[model samples]
Target: MAEANHGKWTYCVDLAREEGRRRTRRRGGFATRAEAAREMKAVLDGELRGVYEDRRTTVASYLREWLAAAKERLAPNTYAGYADCVERDLIPAFGHHRLPDLRPKHIDCWVAAQQDAGRGRVTIYRVVSTLRNALNAAVRSWRLRYNPAKHSVPPKPRAAERTCWTPDEAAAFLRHNAEHYADRLTDLFEVMLGTGMRRGEVLALHWSDVHLMDRKLYVRWTLAAVNNNESLFREPKTEASRAWISLSPRVMAALHRQAALQVAAHPDGRLEGLVFAKPDGLPLRPQWVLDQLRKRTAELGLPKIGLHDLRHTAASIMIAMGIPIAVVSKTLRHTTLAITINLYGHLLKDSADEAVKALAAALDRADAERGASESPLPLAA
Candidate 1:
């Protein structure tokens, strides 16, 4: 602070690192020293209030922290996805803007820009949802008046119908697998195709989870990355996810064969080690598996799809083959039958069409039997 001149105040704030080095800082000017002091005090108060957050914290900054905390509570691979959104998409657009200053129109405009920039509707929807949730928390805890992100209408996501592999497509993938990555990864793929287990679930498998004697595999956990420094093994996302999946004879056989291979290769045939480990017996990272899938798809000239679609494809194929929906839902370890029906209901509708035809045929047979059994002479009707 500088001495007063003619009762006018002059003051300066030191914006320096903890080590005592000074750096360029934001400055304000006032007419009186006392007034300057007051202004500085107010600014300092606001900074202290937002310190847990950063000074001049914006929607984007707190969102990053919220995302970090949320990531800590989620599985590793899931957190990686959320972080990607925070870094590459959300922060770039709204990082510096204050929360209170944001308006619905601001969010709407940003959403439009993202759509114009070629981001998928689903991706944009997630970005807005993530921001809305973080700001909602701020409103509850941080003196924020409103959640502007929630005030804006979420951009409509384009309808994304599941595209499962057809029987022929599945056959091609299986044949390719057998030819190239046979015995090891091929068996794993077959198990996924047969049981509709997610990639993470399949990879997270342990010999203990595989109840071969009971013809079921317990889906109790999934593999995920929590952060750069750790991989987390987490329970299935939903209670419904923690169910038993009945396996077919072929699937059981494949798993048995896989177990034997693991025994011969891994020390003590450790059933507790990761189901899918690296050649050197380390846990396989999920991204590496995804990369492998992508490369294989490119080589085979097949349309690129997510590993999750393999689960959907398995369910869809079974539905097409006249498997009951409830069984399929259980096999897929879905939380609700509604979810299974929503995703694969169209397949079920097709099945229903066939069922109706068979029902009609039975009714016609009953009518024929009644007419034939009646005594023609019964009377002088």
Candidate 2:
């Protein structure tokens, strides 16, 4: 053990292996030797648990290494997102800080700084999530003693008041499209508003997946934009999402029309591979859908909503019609009922109110029936 004076007695523990193989830890610049000893004690205690890291590793270096290792196993989109968080947000904010020295307060301060820089809670949530996940991997691999980010509270995403078209509004939008802009994409919107399929899921729809005769559709895959403007076809969001869902009558009718359109467009009489393709049989871009919807709705004086809001419209329509939440969960193919509840449970407000009213009405009716029956029995006796 060696003690040096750098404004105070800074100490180094000589955890030397026999035969002069040296393993040492140094901590410094404390007001008291006792303070240094306390930190030294903590480090010694942690060493027993295989929790010691080379104290020289900075947050930036560790995150870069984590990203390099993780990118191989991650999905293209996921890897891209983590890279952005590490390079653009996390490393910039915390690069110089030692990885193992991070604390909950440091993470909290970073979040506040993010807010000051005009990042939303959702964005902050994602960035912090990336940091936490990286550190978690570090801890498991013995690069980090513990994840201080685990104790940190990232900003909670305020569930923005989800604005969506009502059934009436959706019907009007469809009618407007059919009346004025009866294109291939019109059927796309029709299917989305009816089946509650996501924009990517709908865009990736294949004729093979659509069972017109059975009034069902299979959500086999989805499309994603990754690696600049390039697009990739990927699996459904979750295993639960890869499911077969029933089609409504309107959706089935739209499919029949889409088949006719596809057949007439090509010399081959058969409805081809993609149910919704461009005139030249190219896959329609999601940006085209977004732009068209925005443009058309603006012309028609309808409230502006994205393709995703059409999905919310479908769920809202089902909820308004008194469909069971469990059925909605299955239709949407949420990984769990809790996930379904968390996202769309607010829409069930009317259902809850209706349930309470029904219970009260039943009780009242039962009391009246009992009163009448008791008096009649007395008269009969």
Candidate 3:
């Protein structure tokens, strides 16, 4: 060990391989001789345990490498999100630091800076989570001893309240659609609101999957947009999302109308094409759909909502009609019942109140009957 020109301590070690080949490892930038000695000993111990890691890797390099590998495993949309956070956020903030030199304080300061910069809490949370995930991969690969971002991650932001329309509002919106803009989206919105299918699931629906005679449709695929440009047909969001859904009468009618339009447009009967598509049979752009929805809702003087809100509106309607929560969960195809409950619990308040009222009425009637029976026996005596 020796002092460097930069006024920091440096150390070197030599090792022999099983084949008698020799290798040298050097490290520097320790502030004191004692610190250098401690690091050298730790390195030697790591080498003995066969867990040695190169300390020269920088955050930017490792993060990029991790992202490249992640692309193959993650869904296109998910990978796009991760790539955005890594390139636009993580790289700029922590890129210059050596991977091994990163500490919790560095992450803490960066998070503080982000907060001070007026960034949204959700964006900050996602970016920090990306860092933590990348560092976790490094630790698993033996490139990191511990993840500095592990405990420094910000609390997840609360989900925004969903804007849902009531049944009357939904009907009015549909009526407006039929009167002013009777197009493919009219039937699309009808199907979405009637059956509680996700926007992606409905867009990716193929005519072959629809059993109109049986009033059911299979959800096998979902159309995912990557970077708001390219669309890819991926599997359903979850295994439960791929199951068959029973269609309502109105939804079946909408499908029948859509089929008639498609059949009239394509004399060849494009049964294998998407159930909801453009005149050329290509999938409709999600953003374009949102823009149209906004325009129509504004014209009808309804609350501004997105395509996903149609799904929420369906769920709220079902809950209001006294559908069982489990059935609602199945209809929504949530991965877990808890997810359904967490999302729609607020809507169940009326049902809960009604349930307790019925229970109280039953108990009161039983108590009255018992009191009359005891008093009648005394009167007869």
Candidate 4:
């Protein structure tokens, strides 16, 4: 650093470059020489560590580049969400900071602001997760010495209490929908109830995937809304999620009606036409499905639930009707049986009681059989 006659300390550094050219980076107007020296030391340390990306680049620009490069690797829906979080929240918070200047405190402050502003845990969690991932990419690329976002902790998301309608309530709602709003919800809701398929899986269903004779259907792809007023058919969620699901007779009958309706609505359309498309032949957006359910539930004066809640209700119905846990787990296409058990453990509480009772009855029967044999045993034995 060199001081002029005015006596304000100035600092300059030869920043290390990842490429051919060394760049001149400078700062000025520090009140004390020690302050300028400290800044100079930090710059030299960062350069020696080979962790500086340019001090000129903002977090927002770097994050956008990182996300663009990451899009091809991330799932369509997942990438879409990451983009949304960055654009809506992360970029706005740290966008102005130079890449090297983004400290852990900045992230900590952002999280605090989010929580204090009444953001939900899940929302905060997603934003934090997205930021962590972006910064992780930066670390891998040698853009930063470490990820500040690793220390960015949002409030832990509490496991949501599953709120679902009982069998009677479900039946009543279906009856109401079929009677009052037949055109909007009945068949789709029935399919979900029967199969317990996820929202994406159900909406992505195609006529060809349905086997009327076998009373089953194959999950092939998911309908995802990745951008503004647009939707795309992407692959199923995971390897486990792509499987044939058994169909109940009610579900089969609904499919039959749906087929007829599909034919009537879009005759001579694509060969693998969507089973649940808008009237204009476009695939239904996930939001549209949610809005329909929300509106219908409000209209019926019933407890409102999302599409996933319907899946949960279906799981309860299956478990309560004596379907095996493993079977239910496979039917729901959970990655692991443990996940299924954890999510629906409350509904399966009776299973433990039933198991104990069953074991006791078996032992009692065995004892009685042994007593009968003892009485029949003669001295010849």
Among the numbered candidates, top TM-score falls to 3
- Which of the predicted structures, 1 or 4, would earn the higher lDDT when compared with the native? 4
The estimated TM-scores of all candidates read 0.73, 0.80, 0.87, 0.79
Tens digits of lDDT, candidate 1, 1-381: 544455455545554365777643444445656667665665566446652222245767777778867866765666677778778877888887765567788789998888788977788887788778777777777546567887665656766776678889887887898788866677878888888888878888877787878898788788765553465677888888888888888788778877788888766756556566777756667676677777777888887877888888898888878889998887777778898888887777777888899999999999999999987875575
Residue lDDT tens for model 4, 108-148: 88788877999888998999898898888888888788888
What do the candidate models score in CA lDDT, each in turn? 0.75, 0.83, 0.89, 0.84
Off by over 4 Å in 3: 1-43, 48-51, 369-381
What are the clash counts of all predictions, listed in order? 6, 0, 0, 0
lDDT of model 3, residue 288? 92
Q: How close is candidate 1 to the true structure, as a TM-score?
A: 0.73
Write the residue-wise lDDT of candidate 2 on 1-381 in tens digits: 234544575667766466878788676666777766766776776667766665557999999999999877787889999999899988878888988788889889988887898977888899899999999998998777778898675657777767888777788889999999888878899999888999889888999998888898899978786753667778886799899989888899899999998888778687768888778776688888899999888877888898888888888888889999999888888899998788888899989999999999999999999888875545565
Give candidate 1's error at residue 149 in angstroms.
1.6
Off by over 4 Å in 2: 1-47, 267-270, 372-381
Say which candidate scores most in lDDT: 3
Q: Please give the distance, in angstroms, between residue 353's alpha carbon in candidate 4 and its true position after superposition.
A: 2.2
Q: What tens-digit string does per-residue lDDT give for candidate 3 at 72-101?
A: 889999899999998898989899998888
In model 2, state the lDDT of residue 337: 92
**How much does candidate 3 score in TM-score?**
0.87
**Which of candidates 3 and 4 reaches a greater TM-score?**
3
Give the root-mean-square deviation of each candidate in angstroms: 8.6, 6.2, 4.7, 5.7
Record all residue pairs in model 1 with backbone atoms less than 3 Å apart, i.e. clashing.
Answer: 9-32, 9-33, 76-224, 76-225, 76-226, 77-225
Model 2 scores a C-alpha lDDT of: 0.83
Kindly report the root-mean-square deviation of model 1 from the true structure over all alpha carbons.
8.6
